[model samples]
Target: MFNKIVLENGLRIVTENIPYVKSVSIGIWIEIGSRFENQSNNGISHFIEHMLFKGTENRTAKQIAESIDSVGGQLNAFTSKEFTCFYAKVLDEHLPLAVDVLADMIFNSKFNEEDIIKEKNVVFEEINMYEDSPEDLVHDLICQTMFDGHPLAYPILGSSSILEKINKKNVLDYYKQYYTPNNTVISIAGNFDTDKTIELIYKYFSNWIPVKKEKDEQCPPMFYRRIMGKTKNTEQLHLCLGMKGVPQGTNEMYHLMVLNNIFGGSMSSRLFQKIREERGLAYSIYSYPSSYKDTGMFTIYVGLNPNYVSTVLQLITEEIDKIKNGGMTSDEIYKSKEQLKGNYILGLESTSSRMSSMGKSELLHGKIYRPKEILEMIDSVQREDVENIAKEVLDFNRLNISFVGDINNNQIESNFKKIIG
Candidate 1:
């Protein structure tokens, strides 16, 4: 069982105590990310995540690193489309030092001008690194094509041109506007005294006052159907086919999970078996569902010789058509349910995973389903539920496509229309 407490200023603290483990994982989750920014400040959320580690009022960057390192602990952070997280893992005895270091970074980071300029260059290099990977670049291309005009399409790592213009004032303003106490959640898991942990959290975070910022109304992104391509000089063509999917915090997500597992999510799935095992057409082929707050995308990816694009796509289309036309068996559904339960249970064995699961759930959905409840939900998904979600998610007319590598866009688009139509 997990415990939750809400401070007077609306800061939420959630914890799970595991008496057997000696280490504890703590996460500070903020409900702000690229989705909250506009064209001018597209990657500010991710940028701030980097800056918070550079230095703070009381500790130099080296000292911050040493604080955790001296204790044999780990510290890191990441930014996503909808949120950002800074986390640390240390032995239970070092929890106080971890909390103090993290709180200092959050509340007193000095986003100096010199650091801003230097980090911009670092982020630019990071973008270059991403561009070098055709497989990874193609996935972002799919989002740009599917979400076209929405902020959700904005890359977490903003483009160099926009990032170059961001100054300390811009960073500070954005940070002040979104990084509020009420907009955050702290989650901890592993061995600890629950009462002592709560008091420790309050000691570090209670006095932090909330900021008043006007709420920005976010309209859900509309899914667009278009073929987007990037001409990269790479050996194999990287491809992504996307369709509409369900949003977060819904029963429909479980249904889609069961459907995805049987379709292409696992090694024994149809896409892997037919494309890689039997025909040996591609080295990699898979599908996944990415859900956001209000909308989601189901993506299928394949990496193969450009010469084999037509054959691979045709095989993928055939699989989709088969599933749409009542090809899935009850046995597949039962097996997928068991697989999901096993994976979920195993993932909980890690304190970091549990902390993340609790933090994201409380920050986004304001509720966390216990393991038994989630397993029951997965078990209860009937064949009809999977079929219904499949029909909704696998609409051929609404599918959007993206590709990267040495291929002619016109030829690939023409082939897609001819085969998928």
Candidate 2:
């Protein structure tokens, strides 16, 4: 069971006690990310995330690290399309430290000028590192192409041009706009007293004055969401294709996940078997769904020899069509459900993953749908549910394709339209 508490000031705290675990993981989830920015402030959300760890009103950067380190705890954070998280794992004895430091970073960052100038260079180097990695490059190109004119197209690691000009003022302004208890969730799971944890969290978090922005001013929809294609310089041909899918929390999302597993998400999935092992096309191939607050994406990716790229793409399209038109066998449906259940149980074993699950659920849905409830929901899915989702999202006409790698005689780009069709 999961328990929820709302403070007088409107901060939602969700707690779960896993007695079998020796450690507790706590996550502070803020419902703001790249999708909240516009072209001028493209990567400000991510930049703000980096700046928070520099220091807060009560603790210096080194002190913050040492506090967690002294407890043998781990701390890290990430910025995503629809949310940002600062998370930590520590012995149950140190839950108060985890909550205090994570809350301080969220509500009390100083946004010091010296830190600002230094961190911009750090961010710039991070962008350069991303540029050097082919995997990151391909996904970046896909988002840019798919959401062409929207803020979602902005790279999480701001473009070098944007990062060079980012300043303390920009970081502070973004921070003030989005980081607040009203816009945040605190989730903790593992071996901790739920009542004591809530008391400590409320002690630190109750006075968070909500950051308010004028409702009259509206930013445009953050994602244009279309198909994007590109050619890049690399050894193997890289292919990415997808279309918009359901928003988070939709019942269809459960079906989509199960379908994706049977189609491309699992090691025994069609794409992995056909493209990787049976045909020797490439080393990696899979499909996944990315969820945002109000919208999401269904994507397929493969890396293959240039000579085999066309066949691989054709096979991918054919398999999708097969799923939509012919649907799955009874055994496929049963196995996919089993895989889904296994994954859910296995994922909950980690403190980080469990806390993240509760944090995001509370951020989006106002409560943590208990893990047992979620498993029951997954078990309730049927063949028709999976087929309906496949037909709903597999429309090639409404999709985007991103191709990376330098093919000496590249016909993949030239033949993409015909091949996908």
Candidate 3:
């Protein structure tokens, strides 16, 4: 069960109490990320995530880390396409300390000029590390190709050139604009008294004033049918195929999940069986859906020998065609639903996972679906739903391709044209 409270300043706090557990997980979710940035400040959200850990007014970076470690607790943060989270896991008795430390960091993080300069170098190295990983780089390429001119295509780790020009003034201005009570949600799970937990949250967060600013209208990204390649000297070609998919918080998302599980989302999935298990064409091949506020993308990725690209692509197309031509069976759908249910239920065993799920749900959709409700939604998915979603999302004509390796651009273009046509 989940309990929620909304502060006078619009800050929302959500919690789930698990009496059997001795630990608690808490997360502060902010609904701002790379999508909120423009071309000039592309990586500022992630940058700010790093700065928050550097130091706070009352605590040095070492003390902040030691404060959690001394109590046998864990603390970390991450930035994604749609949001950012700073979280901690600690014993139930230490919940108040966790809250105080996190609040102090969020409220008093010193964005010193020297720290900014030092962190910029660190970010530059991080970008360099990303550049060296072609497998990871190819996924970013697919996004850049699929959403040709949208902010959704922007890299979460902005380029070195642009990041170099971002100074303290830019960082503070961007942080001030987006880091407000209304745009934030604090989610906690595991053993705690709900009444007392609410009081503790109020102590640290109730005074935060909501920022008055006009919200930016988000434009849905236009999916492009194009091929993009990066020439790199690597042993295997990393390729990604992208197409349109449904947005977040929709029944169609469940339908897509069922379809993905049968198609390429699992080890026993059709793509894995055909390409790797049978033919030995690739070591890694899988498909996933990336859903956002207003739009989404379904992507298929495979790393294979450059010479076998044509064979692997044809096999992938065959599998997609089968799904499009009513090849999925009732058994597959049933098993997938069971797999999803098991995965969801097992994930709840962890306090961190529960905290994350509640935070992301309330922060994005403004509602948290109970376990019973979610299981019912999954069980309600019928054959027609999966089949309809397959036909709608598996349009080869609109496919966009992105690849990285020693393969020639002309070769990739020729293979794509032949297989797709």
For residues 171-263, what per-residue lDDT tens digits would candidate 3 score against the true structure? Answer: 999989889999999999999999999999999999898998877897898776899989999999999999999999999999999999999
Give the clashing pairs for model 2. Answer: 227-400, 228-401, 234-406
Task: Provide the lDDT at 105 for model 1.
Answer: 99
Task: Give the distance in Å from residue 382's predicted Cα in candidate 1 to where it truly belongs.
Answer: 0.5
Model 3 per-residue lDDT at 52:
96
Tens-place lDDT per residue, model 1, 175-264, is 988888999999999999999999999998999899877768878887756999999788999999999999998999999999999999
TM-score of 3: 0.99
Which residue pairs in model 1 clash with each other? Answer: none
TM-score rank order: 3, 1, 2
lDDT of 2 by residue, 229-331 (tens): 4456678777788677777887888998988888999899988998888888889999998776566778888887777877888888888878989668979
Best by lDDT: 3
CA error at residue 379 for candidate 1, angstroms = 0.7
TM-score of each: 0.99, 0.93, 0.99
Better of 2 and 3 by TM-score: 3
Clashes of 3: 0
Q: In candidate 2, where is summed lDDT lowest over 10 consecutive residues?
A: 215-224
lDDT of predicted model 2: 0.81
